[model samples]
Target: MTRVRGTPSPSAPARDDVTSLLRHASLTRFLIARVGSITAQQMLMLAISWHMYDLTSSAWDLGLVGLFQFIPGLATTLLAGHCADRMHRGRMVAICLAAQAVTAALLVVSTATHSVTREVLLGLSLVLGAIRPFQMAGQQALLPMLVPPSLLARSMALSTVVQQISVIAGPALGGVLFAISVVTVYLTSAALFCMSAVMYAFVRYDYIPSPREPVTAESILAGLRFIWRNPLLLGGISLDLFAVLFGGATALLPVYAKEILHVGPQGLGLLRSAPAAGALCVGLILSRRAIGSGVGKKLLIAVAVYGISIAGFGLSRWFPASLLLLAISGGADTISVIVRQTLVQLETPDRMRGRVAAVNTLFIGASNQLGEFESGVTASALGVVGSVVLGGCATILVSLMWSRLFKPLATRDALR
Candidate 1:
């Protein structure tokens, strides 16, 4: 892992420490809504997946849940980014949450009436698919408004902490609630989404609305053009796309659990959470002592470390060693993620943030979804262990190649 340079410089303005940043009411409220909505959304998805599998025991039908969600998101995300820039972003966020809440509420009614089916669930997944791109664009673009520029890095770190915790907790909470009753889980998620929506409505921030640009192909493609023109942004964003696209080690946890480790479903659950747990720990540390100088080098090194960690895991036979390797990989990833996000957000102008964030979000989504598919196909051809090891090596090589290709990203000393 890359070493932390030091604590916040005493001479720096805005008192950019975790406690001071968290003291801001607007930032606090945004975080609360972010965690709430994300958790509820994860729980909602978990319940829906289980519901679909319970109804139809076919693996193909179970797979349609992701396919349904991805198709709509791919189609509408660019448009959603435009909407984020042209509208009250907070209101866009609120509307998205409300829409999700309505979907969950409908599920509760459908489940009660015994009318819920796989088709119904998939259709609702499509609705979620359409709404999330807007929600994500709004949320990313709004955070810069809630804090001073000096504090933005720490704020991003802290936000990552909340996000990792929510990702870990959401599914566990939903699983427990689901064991009691499916409808009960859906009801709770709906209430949480409603709470999140109301909180976002009350949250206030300073935003200078951009003058409405006439809709054109150029307007829609502005984000892409901007990223292409900027080496730093292109390197940071593409690094994630390729690194995650290759280093999808976790997607094969089931094989490790059943065949290699001799553990069952319970162990798979523990294995799945290890990455988030590691990420949460690192995020907490970064929240206080944010990464300082040598930002670009650290970012590259972190990706290399992550790839190495994945390779290490591919060879581990013991459960404890496997868990540690996975944790290390997650921690390394957290470093790269914070650095990339800070650079992307700080370097981009406010007017272009929505569009930039949309492209960023698109790459993130595509990497995750396709990364699993890549893993699956490779596992079939090369065998699971061989696939994972080769992928990790490829990730390391990519990091090396990126250093030469994006010298500005690799040689930079500060995010600002």
Candidate 2:
């Protein structure tokens, strides 16, 4: 096969032609596949939240949605990751996309028919959550196949920004569309999922998984043991996990919009977007700049920045101030996340990528959805502001402690 002008094969490090890798068509298609799926997912979330709240007018219902979403992620992540390694990764991704698209269509039809019941919503949410971990794991594993290692960092960063773009737009659009008709929101979200499935269909690249002997239970266990023993990989994944577990404030946006900031639903959209907006800007910067040695230290500092920004946002009353603070928080948090993801991708062997990526997904999924549950519970117990402030402080302290504990992992340079 002829290599593109910019993209190197997986065997080559991407540092040689970073510019071309970023601009390559195949990479762009991969990005589209990523962005479309993520955007549709977030849109469905916005729709679900808005629709549920509109029906019940209860915060507890919103929290329950988070619970349902997180449970499947925790339960299925390892299995999903294992499958990614053993199966055709692209096809695995396609299967997940198809499942999600079906869920989206179901959501739309239910809404349009006015048959949207709580039971139906909860069931679909569970199915979506179950499949999402695999989609996430598969995509991450498939990435090294799309670009060279040197460019993996940039590609991952770019992928993050692109997903954020959808998130930034999805909720705001969902909010507006929901006011007009929940059916409209669901239909639009379903359309995006279909687009994503179509994009994945066209990706056309085959990822060659590591050739190992016959698949057995021991082989899967070996992947788990690898992550268990690798201090750097363990530390990198844990660092981000613990940090976000405490500091994730996305769950509190609705409360802030209503009680504290007085922005209402539209304001909620903007508030939800603040962090992504900041992360998007930072992603662009990292795409141009190369990561250096001692990225561990950088990761720690960035998380601290993230903690401080979350704290500042917690205290903020002005909309613009809150937005700016969240943006700063987003930027700092993004750097830490990107570094962690890059390290995970670089450190793992090809044979173990699915398992390791699945573990990564489990931690991150916990940080995101379970963290939301924690935040909501804490905010309900304490005030929203109190929860945000305390969570931010905990995040900073945890990152510092983890940095010390994982000193060996932090100090090492990239594998390439």
Candidate 3:
């Protein structure tokens, strides 16, 4: 049968893909909780970083905050992953969020009582860090259950957008509140976490228990083996791991605000928020459009762009120029994130998602916290600008090397 000359195709309705995904009740509730909890976490991070720097005025101390948080996460990765696969994910997440809320509340009380100390902050970081992996692994595994397989990419993209939005708003709000009173920032964060817990309680999804396997070294090692066996997954995770490890500039933002940029707390907030704003914009675009073919090449190109932008930011003295560069870097990074996360989730089985996600979390923790520690140490030796510029250059080199090393990843044509 011949088609009409001006007739639209069957795929015309697909233009509203993101809206369709959001219509799922479970997914919608999850997104709301994700946004609120993530925003509060971001806000708390800024407040803690600022407080630490104000207390010690040392880059090493700033780095130590990340290190402190990371140690607990590292120590708990395997066990957390195993638990997520077997446990009630919603309840697990709710409990973790409640713990965080309590931590924030403690901070509020400490600040109000004139008893806030670096030791207390570090201790709280350790607690939160320990709980974070389980929370993340459960959430990652739970996501697939909320939507059909066809909508998985869109769901991930939308979830990322919510996270980016939180990143944008959280720090800005924190900065303003922090300027008024540290206690106010802590109290606000605690309230937000409580709100997120309530939302998590309302999310409804059918849980499927994975095949029972005795908890042992061999069972725990399965996730690592799976990632190792899949070259594409290995490459994607390592690329992100190395790129962020070398290119991270966040740890030194306070230095830029005080010594180099000469902008105070508000300016620091802008600096921190710039990247997330950029990521949010990109996430919105990707939610409407697919990445299409040549996924591997696109990921590599985005990472290289991220490195170049980061280096540009490092060298820029003007605040506006720096913000623009960081935004560019953030946008580029968002592309890579979407690609990597899609690859991991689509490739892994539901039963194994938690463990695989846990491994992914380890890479993330290393790239972020360990990277911050690296940045701090290097900054102490090379100065802030020099360290950032060098790290960015290293990131560019990593993208180039990884492209040649992981041929499968470079040659990948589709996410699935």
Residues 1-416, candidate 3, lDDT per residue (tens digit)?
A: 11212323323343456877767778888999998999899899999999889888999988888888899988898777888888767777888899899999999999899898889988988998898898888888778777766667777788889999999899999989977898999999999999998888777776655677799987777788999999999999999999999999998999999889999889999999999989999999988888889999999999999999999999999999999999999999999999999899889987788899889988898899889999999999999999999999999999999999999999999865
lDDT of 2 by residue, 1-416 (tens): 22334565657644533456556676788788877787778778877776666677555666667778899897788887778887777778878888888898898788778899877877887888898898888888877667666577877777878877877888778777757777887888788887887787666455554565565667656656787899988888888788888898887787788788988878887888888899888887877676667787888889898988888888999999999999998899888878888888888877778888888888888888778778878877787899899999999898789768999766765434
Ranking by lDDT: 3, 1, 2
Off by over 4 Å in 1: 1-12, 48-64, 106-122, 249-269, 314-319, 376-390
Q: How close is candidate 3 to the true structure, as a TM-score?
A: 0.95
**lDDT by candidate, in order shown:** 0.81, 0.79, 0.87
Model 3 clashing residue pairs (backbone): none
RMSD from true fold, candidate 3? 5.1
- Candidate 1 per-residue lDDT over residues 137-253, each given as its tens digit: 888888877776777889899998998887677766776775678898899999999999998887786555678788787887898899999999999999999998898765566
Candidate 3 off by > 4 Å: 1-15
Give the best candidate by lDDT. Answer: 3
Top-TM-score structure, candidate number: 3
Off by over 4 Å in 2: 1-19, 208-217, 413-416
TM-score for all models, in order of appearance? 0.86, 0.92, 0.95
Cα RMSD, each candidate: 5.0, 2.7, 5.1
Candidate 1 clashing pairs, residues 3+ apart or interchain: none
Q: Indicate whether candidate 1 or candidate 3 has the larger lDDT.
A: 3
